[model samples]
Target: MEFQQLASFVEVARLLNFSKAADKLHITQSTMSARIQKLEQELGVPLFIRLGKSIRLSKYGETLLPYALQSIQAMQKGMKKIEEQKSDQTRRLTISAANPFAGIFLPPILAALHTLVPEISIQVLRNTGYSDEMYKMVMDSQIHLAFINNPHEPGVYSEESAVCLIPLYEDDFVLVARPNHPLTGRDRVSTADIKPYPLLFMGQKTSISKHMLRYFEQQQMKQQDKLEINSIPGIKEMLKQTDMVSMFPRLIVRGDLENRDLVEIPMRQPAPPLVTYLACQHDEIEPHLLKIIQESLARTITELGHPCRLFAERLA
Candidate 1:
């Protein structure tokens, strides 16, 4: 029944010589015989055929060999599973990011994380609506870490939320127009030029979107007149047909910018850059999640690709 007894039984069965088995097990011959006898007694079967000084296995002993080997193997397997689960429970890093966080930033970070900590599992809350929702989730202990682009909304800097935002990078928002737009031929456009068409504004919940509203407020343009959508893809799909130009974090549209699917309209106004940050609960147990977030941000900065003169001038 006990592991020690099982080990002794296995050793004795392997050698089939009581004296040698006793020596291998670091016990006296009498002690080894008593343990084997005890095992036979516990199972209520005669395990050995005593032929004077020598011995051999009985039918019961043969059957118990398979059972004992299986029991030991099962115990080892059970212990291994427990260790893996414990590592996951403690080593895990849960990240919640808005949809814009998904495509470019996370992939390289995830690949590097696999190389850094192969045992740790990461859970991503993708297609999420905004930082407010992510903030709520982290406060509830639903997620461990995130890289949130601050919603330029009111109350974002307040202490009511049990979260801390650390600045990682500042990304500018660009007016993204599909190919063949009437204004694509222009060198630059004024804020006045942005309001006439069905503009695909951000869902009002995000800070990036709120910043858009802020830019309009500063420009004194009435964006409330144009079409608005909560989701990014919805805005992109709308732009495929309508004259609706959408805005997004520049890091997110790097591929589009390169391929010309989305052209940056070079707005010359003093617009605020979206401050992308690493956010977490005030009390997080696993500290490794922060490393994962930092490493991911570094990868994001590298992949941003040949920072344009516009980025340098606008960021300045």
Candidate 2:
């Protein structure tokens, strides 16, 4: 059982698709299959069951999943330590974030990090998907930390699963309408009333809205039309011109909230809470990273301020 075989097996299981695993590992599909088959033969159990072209982990594979993930992570850390010694000059700390949180707080965080930790540098990856993908990057040692949305359910390779989650702050989803909208004055707007406007929605592929979309569909309110934009700013822009209402992160529009540029229409049903988090892997905890993580979380409290204070606190 070579480290390469275990690594390939883990990757295949994580994605549940051989082609994606192969693409990620920079290997051909045939090579990826051979490695998984070799690992399976050695273990005397089939790791994956093919359904048409897609793959799912079998019961035996499920039992092995956790250990396979651990083994690969451990080996990667060992290799990273050796590489860290060779570099000697710069300390590498990587952070991945989905679009909403990243765009809002990133500049200040980056500026603060550079000023305080001049000896270290940061690599930031913009991810619009679920927190699970960023968690895998930490497990693979590609990133030491991530500024992410907390997962609703526990994850297999989530850094938050093992290390810690210092939730910086939380925010609620609210409808954004232009300054003069009649609905904003009301104490609560009905889902039925929201149906009348041109609805602008963020894509499900983004961080938190994917989870929120299901709840939205359940209400069964029909909008005149659907405009699927990718960012909070884009949604805000659309609302400015037309009577399009959007469900969005409040943190994205505080300036508009204060000056009455965009009035927040409070909802009948409460919005789902989104906690911005600083997640780190347990075993690879380094001194500078811990310091930076602490500093960043503190800023999320102080700088990002009350837009987050509205929800709840889960400090790690």
Candidate 3:
């Protein structure tokens, strides 16, 4: 049952000499003999056949030898793995975020993170659900860090503790429609300019949707024809089929913009900016790696010009 007992049984079985087994294990002969005896007593079987001057394995010993060797090997492997983890603790890091932000932002940040900490083992958890779910994971220390969009909303993290909310970038919402949509040709578009077209808004619960509703109320315009969509891809596809314009974080639609599949309809006034925050556990994240993550995020945001502008800060 005990690892030490099994190891002694194996050594003695291999050498077939108690003295030689003890020498190999760097233990006294009597101590090694006691270990084998203890194993035999626990298993209710004598492992050795005493034939005066010679010794040979009994039937039970032969059966248990292979099993004992396997157990020992397994334990050795387990110990080795533990040691590796301990030695490389600083090399492992994990981060999580919601689907849209992760897809649009995480890759560049990871690229920069790798450049800065080439030896690190990075684990990115994303699309795990809402920002609140990601926030909880970071708070629980299940993940080392998280990128949360609009974390300021009530009930997102009602109870805050040692976690530091480092603002990564401020992303602005922009009205986007299919490249050749009627509004794209307009020299200037205002809230009224978009009133004639159908509007595709994100779900009401989202910060973007709430902000859009406020914008409409401010302009005193009603969305006569409107649709609520939760999936970003679904909204993009729907826009192509109809003359509907939707508001999205500008960085999110960079690919469509580059392909000219989606064009931004210039506005007289900017939509409310959604600031993406990096939630890091002070106890979980190392100071040096935290700095790397912050710097990498800043670099990536700067490289990708659009709705996102890096918010500078140093981790104390």
Candidate 4:
């Protein structure tokens, strides 16, 4: 029998009155009676003992009552589960970040979210590769949002592209070395000055490396002695112990600079600042949430001694 027939049977069995059961189910008395009659015919047994104005459950109805109640309860639970899934789909956000943003910005962002939007559930995918992979993820809708260094040069992404890029901030790359390192006292450190010391390079694929390479090419300088370490923490630890120097986003080493654990080596000509962007599928994020994220990052930049410049106005 249909679920409606089963539902009618259970309600009638519970209430023991046709009119009350009909009112409870929001069905007409005639409709309720027809449902019961159909259920009885399907089961080949009478479900109610009719005594003029009163009624009681027949033997078959008593046996079927528990099973019908179970079926109705199961259906209700299944429907509730479906609704819960829909709610989660609406409330949840999945975001990816490049390694540097994940390390420097994610914690504060999460803290701001907890205070501002406690009901929102966040799933953060960290260090999921460089800008190209991040761009792909946003374009493919694999993640709701991504924080990455802008992978493209100027005018590379056209208006026809499915992905939208929101400029967040530009992080200046600074040359850093351990306190008291020889280059630290220089008024203006040049590429030739840095050549004697071992240079620690971030992964070549990293945006920082790409920018540094372009800077070196422009300056016609060659780095003879170099070490490549993909992990930022490892590079920092090495800097603390050795005389090696590396270039990093100022915000990444803000604490070290404050504590005098590391000193910035003034460059004769600084490398280009790394511009970060929030990439997403067009119209995938709510405007309010986007504003909150931007404001949070702005707050973080201010807290970090304004190492990065916040972009122009928010995206239209």
Model 4 stretches astray by more than 4 angstroms: 1-89, 114-120, 153-159
- Residue 138 shift from truth in candidate 3, angstroms: 2.1
Pitting candidate 1 against candidate 2, the one with the higher TM-score is 2
Candidate 3 per-residue lDDT over residues 1-316, each given as its tens digit: 8999999999989999999999999999999989988889999999999899778999999999998998897689668758978877756778887646687667877887788778878897645636666777876667877877776556656654557787777777778999889888787788888889988987776656666777778778788988988888899999878899988777778789888889988888767777777787664556676677667666666666554677767667
Stronger candidate by lDDT (3 vs 4): 4
Per-residue C-alpha lDDT of model 4 across residues 1-316, encoded as one tens digit per residue: 8999999998888888999999999999999999999989889999999999889999999999988887887689668758977867646678888867887787888888778888878888767557777777777667878888857544445676678888888888899999989887779988888888888988787777777777777888888888899888899999999999888888788888899989998999887788888888766667777778888888877776665888754656
- Candidate 2's C-alpha runs over 4 A off are 1-76, 86-89, 126-132, 150-166, 217-224, 286-288, 300-305, 310-316
Kindly report which residue pairs in candidate 2 clash with one another: none
lDDT of 1 by residue, 92-112 (tens): 778767646666667777787
Candidate 2 is scored at a TM of 0.65
Measured by C-alpha RMSD in angstroms, how accurate is candidate 4? 15.5
Model 1 / residue 106 / CA error / Å: 2.0
For model 3, give the 10-residue run with minimal summed lDDT: 153-162
Better of 2 and 3 by lDDT: 3
**Candidate 3 stretches greater than 4 Å from native:** 1-92, 111-121, 158-160, 180-182, 187-193, 202-225, 302-307
Tens-place lDDT per residue, model 2, 57-142, is 99999999899888877777678778976878787777777656677666677777888879877787766456767766765667
* Full-model lDDT for every candidate: 0.71, 0.73, 0.79, 0.82
Best by lDDT: 4
Number of the top-ranking candidate, with TM-score as the measure:
4
